[model samples]
Target: MPTAISASVAPQTGAEPRSPGPVSHPAQGKTTEAGGGNPSGIYSAILSRNFPIIGVKEKTFEQLHKKCLEKKVLYLDPEFPPDETSLFYSQKFPIQFVWKRPPEICENPRFIIGGANRTDICQGDLGDCWFLAAIACLTLNERLLFRVIPHDQSFTENYAGIFHFQFWRYGDWVDVVIDDCLPTYNNQLVFTKSNHRNEFWSALLEKAYAKLHGSYEALKGGNTTEAMEDFTGGVTEFFEIKDAPRDMYKIMRKAIERGSLMGCSIDTIVPVQYETRMACGLVRGHAYSVTGLEEALFKGEKVKLVRLRNPWGQVEWNGSWSDGWKDWSFVDKDERARLQHQVTEDGEFWMSYEDFIFHFTKLEICNLTADALESDKLQTWTVSVNEGRWVRGCSAGGCRNFPDTFWTNPQYRLKLLEEDDDPDDSEVICSFLVALMQKNRRKDRKLGANLFTIGFAIYEVPKEMHGNKQHLQKDFFLYNASKARSKTYINMREVSQRFRLPPSEYVIVPSTYEPHQEGEFILRVFSEKRNLSEEAENTISVDRPVPQPGNTNWESEEQQQFRNIFKQIAGDEMEICADELKNVLNTLVKKDQDLKMQGFTLESCRSMIALMDTDGSGRLNLQEFHHLWKKIKAWQKIFKCYDTNHSGTINSYEMRNAVNDAGFHLNSQLYDIITMRYADKHMNIDFDSFICCFVRLEGMFRAFHAFDKDGDGVIKLNVLEWLQLTMYA
Candidate 1:
């Protein structure tokens, strides 16, 4: 018997749950729950807020699709404004939204003209070759294709301006609803189109997918496997043909037999003279779908063959074994008939297995997973996908290249419970496809960021490690991450790597190429055997019990002097408003020769008062003053911790430690400026100067952190540029 595990684990939690065990939602089709204690390890992030379902309608395809038909209108997500949501899409791209029924667009439009086939698809003006290629592969397997595009409704039956498509998002399969109102320019299709004038299923499917991703611009460019996986809840593995396994042909053949959608691409290099097709008749940098694989007997000898179709519906490879090639004449008349050899202008053509291996640079195979619960005859895979963010000073640790911060990024605990029988190897092993893809980079391209160089590292916990120790430690990754169970450090939008490991617990960390480069990512784990996944829920103990301000023993002599200064400004009332705070600042800057306020406006005084006004009384009492002073004292302690000297001053070198200790991780340029601002005659920062500097520094840090809207360590370049020009100037 195989070990069974649930696909969706509970969301991450802060404290340990009352019952330290898996909470099962059996109706969700999860078979087994994770054995749980306290969430001391990766279980911490099981319930993180990163994942957001579009809505909780929980409707079947019949119910949702019928709802649109009843309304006699196309489906429009009330939550998202059709025109203003995505910058690259509806807004900047200038889409003329029009929802017309099949008959409205064409004199006699059909949902699908004849039966759907690879030849039906044609590339339009959009740069979505990857998606069209996947659609072509879908045509080969009607069962899988119909599964994605439900077969219930047609143009004649439910003639509403609405359509729906299903996609596997992260851990769940979701139905995306969209209106038939597509972007058109002067009554012509702007993006993907079909070869048949009356056909609309291919175009409608593209619109539904665009709506699912927030906009049409989002579907501009992507790898085939992403779309193929969405079309079929299949496990996809990509291979660079040059580095493929020894039994690559055998693997491709077996995959084709088991109903796999495959795609391949030539090296993306096009000569300037050849805009579309090269001299060899193959389109440069274009994706082609692998429609069929065959082993035929030619001239009494066995020969392997591959059938490929270009999404453009023209410009095919004019090589050996191509249409009307000399190789076809070697076949007997009966053999040619058996091979179903029909030569036409359609993009599809047959090529020898050898020629295919030589021409294509990359291959992707998406295996249609079998349902293990329904039948024990086939192997069922357990899949878990989690969404995470790489926030700077928090989770934005880079790859193992930056050892100091790399381990600080998110880590998932993968508990492989069972191993498969391997006849070639002595050890029972489990196979895992660790797939990582960064999200939203394509959407942010107009904003000056592209797909970040991304990858993941997987470390196996030693057999002897027990309990919480099963999580890989930071030091363990310092030198030998290369020794990890699986790690692919590369610069690509998505990367999939396979590994065979003995049944054990392991930690997987996905990160970008450089530290602090921020992006959202989805990490998917597919295992041949059932496995459990959880994230470490790390809670920072920042809110420690506060000491009473009345306790004089806690106050140093300098703190007492500061309190006296406050009392003098407040005139024995021991309370100060924004006006009094301004007066106090003016008096102090006048009295202290070292202090300077270059642009200290009344707004600064009000901002400081707002920061310390815990009770929001528009004023700060003695207790509030003490509370605020203690925070300043905390910053002083951090400065002194790095000072390491009783000289009452520290040099520029120590400022880095002070800033980091204070939890404000500024870049090198900002750190230098802040450090130099407070420097004394010898470029040393005195205790008095440190207090003034950090008080303002705290405000600046809080403001800078606000610009990180996604909580990703990265700030928008335009925003940063605006800040640099306005704030300092």
Candidate 2:
């Protein structure tokens, strides 16, 4: 027979609220081209280490560069070499496409012409305007700009043909290094380049980014938030301009004041409208960074204004309040001078807030810290970010809709101790934002690995159960509905939601919307105050302590009673078959009201007999029954321990630990099979099912090892061998 296997809470206080959708969080698909193992032989399932980016150990640009200089050779990245594969994953390589160092394209090259500035970036031949938009905002803050683009190293000083950049990946900042080779056509940069001909920092930065994402073609189009997060390790808020809040201008002010990076765009309604030049001078579907914001007196009224820069480095806005617009006449001359209003056509321009909202379709605010949303300057957030995985059979329990398997998903505990800081709001709720970001989906685009439909749900733990430090099981979810969840599960790189949940103990369950879909993810929760959180687990490892019998332990004359029962159960032959065992077990089950069982099924007895029937007799002899009785007793205790409420079903996820506790190693594949075979509609197993599963698994492993003579985990079973194996198991 075949086997099968199976799965972020947010905080809130009672009432649920909804934010306007679509218009608020509209995302663009192509804005610009720019962006097992084994059963452990126990401890052998995985290499317990954080391997460097893309399986290549990070090479130090300094060490490699110094070595290159000393050896009188140019530095060339061995990992991401200047090759066609690195330049384009799907497109055919252009014949004249050549890779050249900065010096090859110019007589004298400089890392930065003067200093890293927004103007340093000019859209080249790639469709990664979204990435360029983010880069423009990155240049506005020296601290953040330098963090991504290091200040040291120039083209002529000890230049080793190498440069390094830092990007936030998962939960850590990864230092990505690359050689100075730039993809070019006829000695000219092919992608993002600087306005200055001899300057190459922007070009080099683009190359490094392309390397990070696998190829330049993978950077074709994406949301601005994606690049903003990669560059700053910040969380972003999406606001659909047409549906924006009345106080959106104020929110932008606070976000900028808190050192957040911002970008906005006019999205294309149709494919043909992409990059369409509007009469107002703003290009539809083009990425733009919000570089400045201010309020000025116009016609005796305070007019909100926003300044934005098109990454194209040209096409200044041509509307009221734009560069050299007639609207400037409405404001006092002294006020214009104080605000330092300028009329330069450098792709940067200002417009009234009303016009800004009407012109731009979407706004993105990437906050360096959660405090960017706080009105109180002293208030801050307690942020907890966890790296987790949804491994098939072991942890990839689908969504709650699949009640039988959802509990198998990864579980996390989040405790909010304080409420949101709001004097006017009456609800005693904790305001927090939870973002679940899938890892490596973008980098895997070349391999056709798309984003998994990922989302999280939050369930408030009952106060009575909070004292038990164990992973909530399927039974828990079967009884308690999720209080809050993401707007909806979507196949996006990240899904996030802000919630004002009641302060309490909650379990955050993150999963791919489907069973057995495997992937890695980052789950982050930001609370108004310190949050207590960790991965929730009820798994009892073989190395960890298990509940012991008080006073008398097993094997202490208790064996005598067990042996007597086995003898009585086995007839004159001093043995018992599956029928006999079922009769005995059913009799006992009916006699005990506390057991809460409908009696053991025939399948359970058969599995029990198979486990200990060493001789091919299809039954358990006295000695075999003795061994089976001991296991039954021990397993009975384990089931009772998990089914604390004693309605007689244990959490489905506990099966792996239970098998391990019984001294049988379980790899994820085998676990998957067991769950498919035994786990019920509730994603849990009863006492009978548990015993049957463990016994059958034990018997199968034994028979498997017998046939697997070479022990390479492979076996060639003839008809006779197959009969011998399947007949009992």
Candidate 3:
């Protein structure tokens, strides 16, 4: 009965989203699913050229470790250098820090002492308690803990200065490598630390995380859900404890039983910052993990109790339910042992469920299912992840507000193969959640870039458009209504919504609410049942190439003009070099004031010359020149028809038809590549670009036919011939 909220919802009224964290897989009997099979799935990416790494080469642990072992030297990470820059970005330095290894802090250093537990993590001077809480929760599930911290690693073996940790970044798991140099002040760990002085896993893990997000200062403060997702890759749902349903305790019991990661915290409202440290021994803004739930026998009655652990070691809740409170004297030893009640200030304590809701303002539960709407569903979700980009004018077709380019956004096909199985069997629908996340805004701190307003719209695919591999175009979107969409568009890192609809094929268009904002994005769709995913299907079949010479005919006067230009540019033998061809086309293109442009580039003319340079003279002759002139005239007419406003550049929407008009057949795939290549960031195709694209295509097609001896694609090209083809193309 809790008001379930996705990560997208903005903070308001009773509750707001904290950062999400990863959940443990249900495979270890920690969390059980209705079906034993691993139902979660990931969609392969297309057009996933990620943010450039710039100059630094990527490093891997296996390779770096082997190299260090061979050389018998400590591995120093060149990327995240140990310097003050790695400690602070813009925040004022709170202390002069010294960097040290675990051995320097304690003689008998340990990667992990005995076993990992909530007691292992303790907050340092840095305000990253949220991360500490997640680490505490991570210890409860070994399956998830081993993933974030590879268990194979140790201090005794492979004792290199290098270490690595895995974090779920966007839709993929990335291994962040770092050096073992821990920042210290007065010889103590400066950020997140371990309770055992000699223990170093948590400290090194924090360094890897900081390196992943740019610097340690960047990890100053965040929500538990964020760390939970990074650690467990789980779907997180948040609840305002104040607005929680009557069965909130039941929900928690079920979630934890099913391997869901749990974390909570007292409200961190800025206005009440001074009151954060309460008299009852709870920090107002501190984050804590829900490690266990039990019913304590008090006054011969069962009172719901939740076990909480503070990220700061040695802090205990001191209310009536506090350790050694006189009320515990009444409970028998067996019942007390069953509840695991310990009398110590080990940062772990029990608070009555009533007192829990009164003090803890919020709770976050991350699952391995599409339980965004109904968080307690006992199901395994099938997830599909795809990476995409929204280049201005190209793929950044804004929301439906800009109908002209809306279809230009990346399209994904969602095929609901079957409906969810229901005992009642009254309704037939597929339940899925679509989450669209724009990447890298958090790292652009220097540029001051904020999250863009992004969302996705789902439209039922028409019967005819079901199986084609073409992208849906402007016309299709203009005529069809979106079957479902994000609940609302908001400027958050991620915006997601849950939907239950009739089982059918649908097209999901993910885009920024405003057009022309350039950025990379990842799209994720989680379904309770199998959902087949692919790039959006085409709105229609490809139109055949336009007939040669098109429908336009040249008049006697036009032919005379063409001959006059060719003869002047060439000679009696009718030979003209690329420079001459450039001049001739520039002159011809300027003839019509309505079709006026800056004129074709010399490079473009060279391409046109090469297209018909059969003898490889790198020049055009009378016959070839005549053939090219006729084609140019016909193509110019097509451009004029599509450039309705005579803007000299046609909108991307008109590109396909214009290409077809110019006698080049194009399917949706090629058309998509063309737009990404030739169209400017604004998505406009000028005459020069239009001509150049086709010229290259024609040249490549011709080259393929000539080299493909038997008409099959297989070819044996010598180095020189391959160079010639590549250079010319």
Candidate 4:
């Protein structure tokens, strides 16, 4: 459940008041509620009012209910224990109780039980007579019966609970709990008002009918017909009886004992004795259980006893033992054909156990149980499990988990070394190493011991300059480590092995050693451990000292030209808009001019740009351009002079002239400019360079073109003199 809640605390001073901020509360199904007056608040109010019982909003309830009402039937297979005899007996009983009379006259009427209604009871067409009979028995115990039926709440995670069902099979009872609900009329496990009641009922009946035969339509017709349909697994018909034989109760008991219903036909011998006068005639009748045969003392005396009814219920037997029977007066009927009741030739009759078995097509015992068992027809079973221990190691080859092959594996061993105290410097080294490892992993490669041979250097300075110092350190490591690691992997094995120093060796150096420049520290990696070999004796120092005045300012004309060219190419490719182009060119041109004045050549600029293009794409994208630009920004204000005509970009001609003025040959100047400018294979300038060049050239062209008024590309002496005076003024 997702819910939102606010985390803000009330202000202590009680100054006027601040607006409530968003609050996030977990649970309640990711629901968010706003304070006072927000969309969520309003929704919450509406939900609280309309669907109080559901715990969810009215809209949500509506949606869920709508889904439940759709036509769908859920079939479940429950595993019934093989030992459940009592349940088996209970399942033998008939599902329908047929009465000769309508429901109103019956002393006790059968009603739907467990599920929502009789119409909802669906029997999967399996030969599980026991399960079906159990279902019928459960109907007698409605509430207790329903308790075993799984409900929707049972499926919910937090509020779920198990329910048990018991069934009597043979003589004993068996019980089982199921996880899900019995399907409703709509075939869903839940009920809703919108479901079609008639359809549900029809579906249930169809289910039962299908179990008897292959189809449900065959079971339709009359009461006895329906009962017989179920009994013989076919369709059947039933008739009403006005009266029955005197021994109905005895016959009923006997039939119950014998475990089957009896069938017969009836006929009237004489109809005058009937209390309710009506036509009496021969008719077929069915009965169950025979009490005793009435043996008269006299040889010719009429014999009569008792018989019971199996209501698929009817009024009574309309033959010899019927209420209108004249035979009570001892009248003789040699004409057995005239009897009120006639035995159906193939109709059922009570018989001794032996005869019952011989005559009836089928017989089954009905057993009742105190509990019911799960009726799911499907069952699932489980199979197997296994377990153990493992050890792991690291090496250039790869890490491996070992079970049997352990000690001899060099790949799994760890190497350790002691180093002098330099906590900050060590931290920097460790961080750099971690970063390198990450890069290796990203490339789906192993961080081999040899790869660690690459050298690293960390420098520290005063806290006041920490930010700048850290930036420089990061930039240097990122640029150099990437190249060096690749080189180490491809070249020196011994150097790589020695480079695999432990993280602790990179410890920060103490400020005490260099107290005046307190907090200053530096970390350096050796190609080999000290005192290891002759070559290892040589120490190469790459110092990242605090920037000071005397170091060679690498920002020379060549370097500046290289950087400017890369910047133009990178910026153009980046497609930076007009205003940005102006700023970038202004900055780069100014730096280039300054570097030129300082005697830096175009070669130096080219070298710097080459260093910056990490991917070796020969051109810099915006990120690389900006990085290179920052490095040269401090050297000169070349941007001002580059925008000669007061526009933003320097065109080829303008660029050539600018470099020439700075003492660069045309070819060298062009080389610097083109190399710095990002372009496609066709050599077309990119958007960033184009905009910058366009603006810068526009200005330069305006100044120069104005002087060459004749449009001959040359400025006469008079024009130059006039232009100088006007520009000066």
Comparing 3 and 4 by lDDT, which wins? Answer: 3
Name the candidate that leads on lDDT: 2
Q: Which stretches of candidate 4 lie over 4 Å from their true place?
A: 1-203, 208-316, 319-363, 373-729
Task: In model 2, state the lDDT of residue 161.
Answer: 87
The 0-to-1 C-alpha lDDT of every candidate, in the order given, reads 0.62, 0.72, 0.71, 0.26
lDDT of 2 by residue, 1-729 (tens): 111111010001000011222321334211111110112222221122232443235545566777889999887787798888887776785476888988889989988866788877888878787788888877765555666676666888888887877787877777778888887887888888888899887888888888888888777766667887888777876677778899999998886677678888775544466677899898876678887788898888888888788887788788888878876877898988876678776677778889988887778787775422223563456789987877665688878778877887877888988887789989988888888999987788778776676788998999998855566666788888888887667565777778888889898898887777878899999776778877776332223237776744345665655556666878578878888888766765565565667778888898787778788788777677666766777777777777778888876677766776677654444566777778886567888888887777667767777777887877798898789678867
Evaluate residue 690 in candidate 3 and report its C-alpha lDDT on the 0 to 100 scale: 86
Overall local distance difference test of candidate 3: 0.71
**How many clashing pairs does model 3 include?**
19
Quickly count the clashes in candidate 1. 11
- Per-residue CA lDDT of model 1 for 615-648, tens digit only, reads 6577888777776656755765676575665566
TM-score of each: 0.69, 0.72, 0.81, 0.17
What is the descending TM-score order? Answer: 3, 2, 1, 4
lDDT of 2: 0.72
lDDT of 4 at 16: 7
Question: In what order do the candidates fall by lDDT, top score first?
Answer: 2, 3, 1, 4
C-alpha positional error of residue 423 in candidate 1 after TM-score superposition, expressed in Å: 4.2
Tens digits of per-residue lDDT for model 4, 169-215: 11222233322222232233121111222222222322323222222
